[model samples]
Target: MDTNAFRHTLTAFRAPRPGAAPSNTVHRSLAQRQRAAVSQPWLIGASLAGLMIAAPALAQGEAALPTISVSGSQYDADDVRPEGVTTATKTYMAPKDIPQTIDTLEVNKYKSYGINDLATMLDGVPGVNTNYDMRGEGVLIRGFSADSGDIYRDGIRESGQVRRSTANVERIEILKGPGSVLYGRGGGGGIINLVSKQARFDAKSSVTLRGGSWDNYGGTIDINKVVNPHVAVRLTADREQAHSFRSGIRNKNEMISPSILVDTRTGLRWAGQYTYDNVWRVPDRGPVYGELPASVSTHQGFAHPDDYVQDRLRVLRSDLSYDFNPAWSLRWLASKREASQDFDHVFGGTYCNTAGRTATGAACNYRGQLRQNYAWQATNNKTTTHTLDLTGRVDVAGMRHELLMGLEHSSEERQPQVYGTVPFGATINPHNPVWPAKPAQRPAATQNNLHEATSRALYVQDLIHLAPQWKLLVGARYDSYDFDTLNRLTNARRAASGDSVSPRAGLVWQPTAQHSIYTSYSKSYSPYGGRGMLGVSGAQDDEPRYSRQMEAGVKSDWLAGALSTQLAVYDLEHYNIRYQPDAVNFPNDWAVRGKERSRGVELSAAGRLAAAWYVRGGAGVMSAKVVEDRSAPANVGKYLINTALRNGNIFVRYAPQGHWYAELGVTHTSARWINAANTQRLPGYTRWDALVGWRTAPWTVTLALSNLLDKEYWRSTSMPGAPRSVLLSANYQF
Candidate 1:
């Protein structure tokens, strides 16, 4: 039967109440049954029976059809819409049906373009700024700084360091806006979930070797095997090394992953995986505004050759699931991660003494060396998480519902120790060059601290199909947060605990088979000790800080689903923040109470424009400002730091059923203020990149070029951008 006939048939059914009637009461008139269905507090048998016969052939049929591969599908957006596993809602859903903006990045597809780093790979994403500096490799999403808290892997929060190794990642899912319902500590502006590769029944393996300019070289290997019908195993590993365009810098990276899976293919499944990554590079702190002399260029460096930053991470996870039937399932996830970071760098401000005076035994001209000092830090992070959820589909009073209920607990521990030298110990001449052989004196330990934080939350979400073309989504999460910090240097202790409730609501309307319009509002919270350096108590520190986001968007497919588009406008705000920095004398300190908000519009597209032409990319425009500041009223109107007013990037590729293909891409960002006071402006830039490749049945070779113009710009306010570079690579698939 058609949809209307099915819905009409549903109206004439009602289940008996617990104690009011017998089981045969459903044999009644249509009007009476409809009245009973609406008046009763609960729905049971009859409506569910009617839904079972219609659900598989109707709703799930058209709305959840399996993905199909067309021409150019291997390297295009053919699978961007499927999601495979939904990170936004933790439930099965169509990209259009969810009332949020989610962008999927296929790692292999971008690998073909010779982009491996997480920051560079996200250049095409809207509302994101790939502004990674030397101190850390975090980016800005929707005008907010995102670090380890907003990045995850395989449904687990990989604390200490964020997701940066793309070699083992199969796909990256970006969910915009607040995501506190499922992730208690995340989604203030958005969250990125890295999906790793797993063992497959199909025996597939590949090897890739590459080398290019500046002594860059790397190779990767992947092997998969199926020992039996119910068991599979896989191993993946990669290593890369490169010399920097900047002086006194070098880089090396390595990653290895192994996984095993036991799948009955119907009822029960289990999977276990482990990943290890080790990276080393010399950190660079580029020129400071108005602090550097005129002769300085992007290639010049003052850091000692011994300066370096190193990070090592090891993670293990186990996942198990049982499908009771086709409509219901239960899943559990557990993970443990250990990450360590060590860095030694030199930083300084002015060349001369403050007030333009000299203090050395032999007084000299005002021109002097840039006063600098050494800073070293070693941090160890340990994280653990456990999550359990039950998901299923049911019918209530003739309306279909997809439900998710879950509970999760996350804990993190960080041991940080800092060392710094006496001022002027690592000075360097600005005009002339005289390098000191390391610091004459060894730096002394400054601060040693240990921190621990934990969050426990229970969440529930329901998607109700109100009608054939309308849907309503509602969810809420309650979290209990606790934190403690001890300073080994001063023998000081600080502790805090609090609780919060985060809520989400959305409405979706499908006007046609190819288009969906939706609006959503969500809330997220910062748990105790959730910000930088954890939390330092203030008047408002007793309560958990909160953030909220309101968004409206449209998702559509064109050209018979070959092309997909997303347009979204959003208003996001963080409360109990925007306090003056001097109030706490530290960064990321949320003291007093104030407000900061960001309003923006974003548009994105991915698809095959023609038979051989594929296009992808988007743009974002935002107006972000401090609405209120309790400590400094004068700063109330200032814009946020390092956030551009307009940013966009696009990549286009042309490939046929032949042996050759080519791609050209561009990235643009508008001028932006480096400081929150709206001063220290940095010039914007546009960069162009191109690639050409030739492929055979089992071998593919490519040449990639970056920054054709070699224009000089800053990656962030604190770091200069890289110059033009090239890479050549070969891939063998078997």
Candidate 2:
């Protein structure tokens, strides 16, 4: 990627706009209105208003009040609370004021722990789990699966299967529960939004080098410069190449991100950013059957050394904001994203029988129990998205209100040029595997297909302050989705279209600035694509699956707002789930009379326990089950697959003095069913991590040790936890 190309792209969108200055009369009117707003006693106040209201009631005699200051960092040590999050309401509001469970991880915090991967960074979040899928990394939130499509960058949906890097990330925010009102055509599992770093008026630069076990090595550069008082530029880049613990696996990645910020005297500001990423890695399927005996090593990967997947991503975004007055403002955002992938792999199969093995010998033998099945897929997938959002805030009838309206258009296309499925000529034992010789020629390519989808959506949300201590939120969205599929082999084409509407409502009450109680209800939907799924071919296609959630929570700040805690309970259900009645049946074997439900309680706390000790962690207890399944009656009342009854993690850091600190953390996950039938299970496991670091004026060094006990366990059904590994990093700042 050329740095000059980024400059050209940004200049194309920076055309000047002509405007007239406000007249003297208009300025006078604005000043009078600002004065009136300030005089209103019941209007929205700053965070300190809560402390002042509770001081008389909660403070002891002669006890001096702790001084507090609002800093520029998203989160400051003075108060563990975040400045605000936009994903929940499309407007900046404190996390405690939002009626949903929102979690945030600052870049500095994760960097200190030597966490590089997105999945590892989310390990301690309550009610969230990592799962594996053929498409990409999968996330389970509140017992519902959230794919890559559910992830967002700066509030815009990011599609495709690719690993995310934190080199240019400022913070990561997770919004829990149904989100269709703001994001269309998604699951009820919530969304993950990555906020990128932007240019500031101040000049800053840093470089970091990291090395770890498994031949891991990487370097990153972040540099920012202020061109003038009104303009600034920033660039972030990184390159990494490494081999994995799994045999025959290697990883490589490179990324470059450039951004610019422009501020005009007319109260208008624009921020533009572009990112390019290229990633190549050999995909690992982990051990077979979701488990391994002590005699079998977890590093045994079945995929051949030649199998690999490569991905490239490009994203461009622009945000514009103007303040009309002290009480009114307008914001507009536009973004475009393109992603492509190339994959080719031969993987193991899951079924084996003694009779077939005897007849086929080497070809049919699959470790004695499972049969050898070889699958190969070579295809190209691309996704292009364009989105626009308009948001405004004003005071109406002495009440503060924020309004958001948005439009989105997206298209995705997949072309599969080559696909092959056949039994390999050789098989090996799991306990003592033998390498097979490479085939002279690749398998014949037969099937060719193309799939494309286009979607459009309109959404609106409003946050109204009914009183000084009370607030209400309401939102709705309508989506239109169209999909087309063409089979080159059969020359057959199929098209489907569907529509959905989602709505949400919430109410919040803040008795004091440090305490809040709230309840909310929301709805979400996922559309199904195919020929008959929507009655396009004179057959009843499956209707879109719908999910609803009802939640109540209490949020509070303690120790003079230095710590924050939350307790929440929620009930969520998904309806119209498609289930297969009989595996042998040809058509009409699937039905939509299936439902799944999950109810859980979550407790979390993060912040400073004392002046020298910092604590962050949370726990969740969930009960998830298949409430109804007409097609597969036996699955009714069974536990949901891959969902644990209990999960939690806690980390503590102590920095009594000097420039050195030590940290310890533990993560625990309870046993969970591997399948919906609840027959096979993955045992519960616990892992420990430790970190130590020292900082000088311009240099910092750190070491992180993971899996301190060398615990051997299954992270997911087919994914094994990594063995003990160590990472050391050094940073230089200017």
The model with the greatest TM-score is: 1
Which regions of candidate 1 fall more than 4 Å away from where they truly are?
1-85, 112-114, 161-163, 352-368, 420-426, 430-434, 439-442, 533-540, 578-591
Global CA lDDT computed for model 2: 0.65
Encode model 1's per-residue lDDT on 1-734: one tens digit a residue. Answer: 00010011112222321112221121233223222211110111222323322331111000000011111232232223332225677653456778989887767666754566787777647888767655455577887766647776654665664336677776677888888777786538888766676565543567889887778899888776667887677787899888778777678989987766666766676656667888888776644644665577667766666778888888765555677876777766656678888888775445564345443233434455676666788888887776777777788998878788887777778887777544545456665546567765546668778888777888899988888778899999998878888888777777778888989999988767677789999999875477643422212244555789999999877776677788999999988653435545653345655888989999988877789887778899987788987776777878887778899888787878777888888999887787767767878878888888887657778788888788888776556767888888887766
Model 2: per-residue lDDT, tens digit, 1-734?
A: 00110111121111111011111111122222222111100111122223323331211001000001111222323123344455787655566668899887665556654455677677657888776554455678898877635677666666654566666665678888988887777778788877666565443577888888889888888787767777667777888887767777777989887766666746666566667888788877644554334455778666666677777777655455565764455554444556656666656544344444432243443435432445555445455444445555677899766676776666666665555556655656655555576566656657667777787878888878888778888999998888777777777776668899999999988777677789999999876652222111222234678889999999877776667788999999999876445545644355677899999999988777898787878999999899998867899889988788999898887866677778888998898898777888788889998888776557777788889889988777666778998888887776
Q: Give RMSD (Å) of candidate 1 vs. truth.
A: 11.6
Q: What is the C-alpha RMSD of each candidate to the true structure, in Å?
A: 11.6, 11.6
User: Compared to the true structure, candidate 1 yields what TM-score?
Assistant: 0.85
Q: Candidate 1, 518: how far from true, in Å?
A: 0.2
Task: Show model 2 residue runs off by greater than 4 Å.
Answer: 1-81, 112-114, 289-293, 326-330, 349-372, 378-381, 384-386, 417-421, 438-447, 530-542, 579-590
TM of each candidate vs. truth: 0.85, 0.84
What lDDT would each prediction earn against the true structure? 0.66, 0.65
